[model samples]
Target: MSARFTRPGAGTPVPVRFPRIVREALDNGLRIWTIPYGAIPVATTTLVIARGTGDDPADRHGLASLTGDLLDEGAGDLDAIGVAEAFARLGTHLDIDVGPDAMTMSSAGLARQIERTLELLASVVRQPRLEAADFARIRELRVNRLRQLSRSAGTVADRAYVSAVFGDHAYGHGALGTTRALEATTVDDVRGFWAGHIGPAVATLIVVGDVVAVDVAAAARRVFDAWDATIGSSRIDRPVVAPDRRIHLVDRPGAAQSELRIGHLAPGRSTEDYHALVVLNAVLGGQFTSRINRRLREEQGITYGAHTSFDFRRAAGSFACETSVQSDATAGAVRDVIAELGRMREAAIAPEELAAASASLTRGYVRNFETAGQVARAATQLAVHGLPDDTFDRFVPAIEAIGADQVLDVARRHIRPDEATVVVVGDATVTAEALTAIDRPLQASAPEF
Candidate 1:
């Protein structure tokens, strides 16, 4: 007799509990958060300062990014090569990133090397050698990179879209400053920025993996307690998004395909309806099987793929639908994208779709804490966004509680199809006829970069 086995049905998801994160503050106002995870004999440290490109002076855009890149180039007694060798010899890695809101420096190494890594991180943060030679070299590379990006259809569309939507707002420009702005930056400007923004008063240190909260706190105190506390300027004004919708066409002559960017300003991460809006975005275009991708790519074969997302920031963010389609199909793709946006607000999502979207969110929530570094980063984000410590704990529950009605309600309230700024980057001569069919007056311009 032969025995057969049956395939298992979908099983209930196991509940995930995040590790306890202890928060403390040093005498110099440096915030420290330690999360203990002993699964591996390794540790990770991340130091986040509440300064980024948003703090770039009005005339000196991209200064913050340049400052961040120069951190590990040299420090107290180490030159650029020496800094690299120091981490290499210890089998560790230090990475730095600057965003619109904050600059983060992170490292991972063996648990025993935690103290040395923290000391090196402290030097990079507090005593970076922003030498004139280093500044000149980095600035040239950035300018060249910007020039290269200016030629890309996608890059042109992105810059043009934000410029059109935000106008004179600080967020109008990309983090990589314009060629003119990058050329204008000086070493003194960088030093001044570091003095004013990168300090203990506006910084947070996070340590995770194979460490105790008390021990991590003591280590942080040893490294950062004596640092100066110079508070930077207050946050800039929230971007003022105008309610007018316009179709801007960037002339990228002889382009093979048209890059389409359609979006409008949306709520920040702290919105009361964040969970509902997230679920709504899923059904619209947040997932591969979303309506936008399904209709544009799978059904009509207009393009390979289409998607949408909310760029959630501390203040207001934007909801964008991005895709590339044949020049002749640009207008049709735009029409279909707008139609899907409308349907999300007007139609009730099917039960299966809602269940699938909710499941996708809740199921993936556990993966965020799979590593000590990931958990530390998540906690740091919560701190950066001023969210409650329990935010992660409540994430799954909040997503699961979202009903179809709530999705529709949030969609109706947030997704404004009429107010979206439509940007197209392609050969204007070839796409003009198809694009003008949308019934809106087309505004033509060159790439702002």
Candidate 2:
């Protein structure tokens, strides 16, 4: 590490320190990124492919998910049972996770097992069998999860909100996809999806804890040298923000309380307004004393709790306030929530409120990387979003730099009280009538499908 950067807080107003990940690229264009943390005997490695559900073929909404799950069933010469035993014998923890926008294959173990682990990773990504038997089992498991989600009103509200907000955008599809899509997805489709999406051009390797930077880089190169770099989705365009201001009421009979999700599209983590928006969100609905929570829950006694947040994805994400309250109180609670949003958008946040929110945000920023795993995860997120190299190092200072005016400015620009998507999951007949009687200027639309 350079000495100047080493004394991070000793100089600049917004001091920063990059994590010092060694970087290289093989002939195949697979960029290798590594961070060597030699303080412990254990190490973690993660290979993140840019392709996720966002890259799903329109007809095959569940291909990415199926591919992610089947990668661990068997690879190279190992069958499903053999792969399980190998990881178990090595005492390694391996995880495969698929999202709408990306997939991650990660593993952690003693430093001595790096070679074996790397080989396992390569095998899984390079030569998964995607056997018919394993596909049946995975599909069955996903069906069960979907079935469980069907009975949960909260789950129903959440899924409906995203689908309503994003429409046909890549993010519109849920991570656990529809049962019909899963049934239609085939092994060849999984292979083709991986070939197109999981390769070097879209790959980021993060290695942390008890490893030399050079060795980590070399390991990455050895394993990923032949992988394709420009292998993912080609249709990259700025997704249109529909910003439909409507009340989507999901009718679930016998629901005790209405589940609600409100608010609209906000800038992502990469936006220049990101820092200000963070503070603004914290003041409005991000904390216990936040205005939305205080007004809706503490003051009005409409619900036990209510809060707002921004999803902050690689692409545009949702900023939403969510809570559940008695069915009768749903209309009142949502109305109050909107009034608060309008108040926040128009008013200059009081100095005291900004101070407290800033304090909470600063405190949260400090605690964000309390664990090694968290630190690694943060790095992965930063890499994925193409954020500045010094995000973590400058996190606290960034929060401290935003004044009341800056926060209010961001709130005014992004917190759209008039355009927020208010979704309520309850008996539509009761809630719809209540909304009609309230007669607010905001228009309401019924849920379809």
Candidate 3:
């Protein structure tokens, strides 16, 4: 890890100046946020489509995912091989990913090669040809992956955990959708998806690194200006909240141990309690030496590792703790975790521990922007959500401002043990028996297995 703060006696501090904000919209409804960082000749661009898996129609569960993957196969006039050769020749680093909430395509290359990079990016987005054969190939790839994933205790537990917590909601499904969904996907389905989801209307084009605002904006306009401007803006419908608590077990036969996952709903990235909850969770279960990890792993010898984290999505997210341990120790380990969580909520934290967690959090906050890629992504997030450009600058003060009492208060309010959904994946007979031994009800149903 790099040093999170400036060293003592470092040269006199120079006031950091971020790029000035410049925003514009093309005639076709594309929005752009440009930040010029001319210290180096490398330019990075992030092209984000607001539509993601959550926007998929009920009948087209994996359409968005399929569309994202197919974009690089062939576009406009470039074949898949040709596109790869082009980017390689230019020494550009390009990546494309589709998530539950959004789809992003980004690249970084020498500023001199930006025009060609943009051309490749635009072709991928505007003219993707989702061939029937390619669709079948990708589907086969995904199905094979699901088969291999079924053999892992940890994978089974995570799938069951989310399903048990979110039920039939969109958030319940993984970004790739289910194996059955992938099987039913078709080439035309993905093409139609690209038409609706990947366009200027849903676009948030971000250019950061060593380039002027005017020149970067011109590059964006050259590539995306003629692209269809009429695709409608993307919108996500509201989701129904899941129930407070439940226990779900996914049974994988012939397994010696159980993989456990406990989940609860929590605030999203935009919540005001976000910073306080980060501190609270770090003190409770977020760290290697956190209360839950120390008590369950070090003291009880329940598992090799245990950790908790908030999903941090655009809407309300899930908080989850995951670990795999001996089937016989499964229930006891879970109970110990719950006990520590309750203790953290009920008692005031020791001042030294609280300070340490706060300091650690402060350090992590500073490290978040050390790379050009990180800065580009953060800038895109700010533009997409209309957040303050100074969002991260206030992070340290916000964490430091949180009082110990406030951490306890948030813990008490957010960490509800009874409302949690617990999932254990292992042999059905042994797993259910173990859970039953702990006085929790056990139902022998089909797990995400």
Candidate achieving the largest TM-score: 1
lDDT score for candidate 1 against the true structure? 0.85
Error of 3 at 58 (Å): 2.3
Return whichever of 1 and 2 wins on TM-score: 1
TM-scores for every predicted model: 0.96, 0.91, 0.91
Per-residue C-alpha lDDT of model 1 across residues 1-449, encoded as one tens digit per residue: 33456633334555677788788998888999888886798988899888877787778878889988888889999999999999877798789999878889888888778888888888888789999999999999899999899888899899888778767776777888788888888999888888888998888898889987888888888988778857667575668767647788988788889999998888888889889988988888988989999999999998999999998887777899999998888888989988888888788899989988888778767777888788878977887788888788888888889999999898898999988889988888888888788877788966545
Q: Is candidate 1 or candidate 2 better by lDDT?
A: 1
lDDT string for model 2 (310-376, tens) is 8877777788999998888889998898998888868688877877877776654545554446567
What lDDT tens digits, residue by residue, belong to model 3 across residues 8-77?
3322222233446678788777877777765778878888877787777775566787788888887777
TM-score of 3: 0.91
Native RMSD of candidate 3 (Å): 4.0
Per-candidate RMSD, Å: 2.6, 6.1, 4.0
- Give the worst 10-residue stretch by lDDT in candidate 2: 7-16
Tell me how candidate 2 scores on lDDT: 0.76
Candidate 3 backbone collisions, by pair: 37-210, 245-419
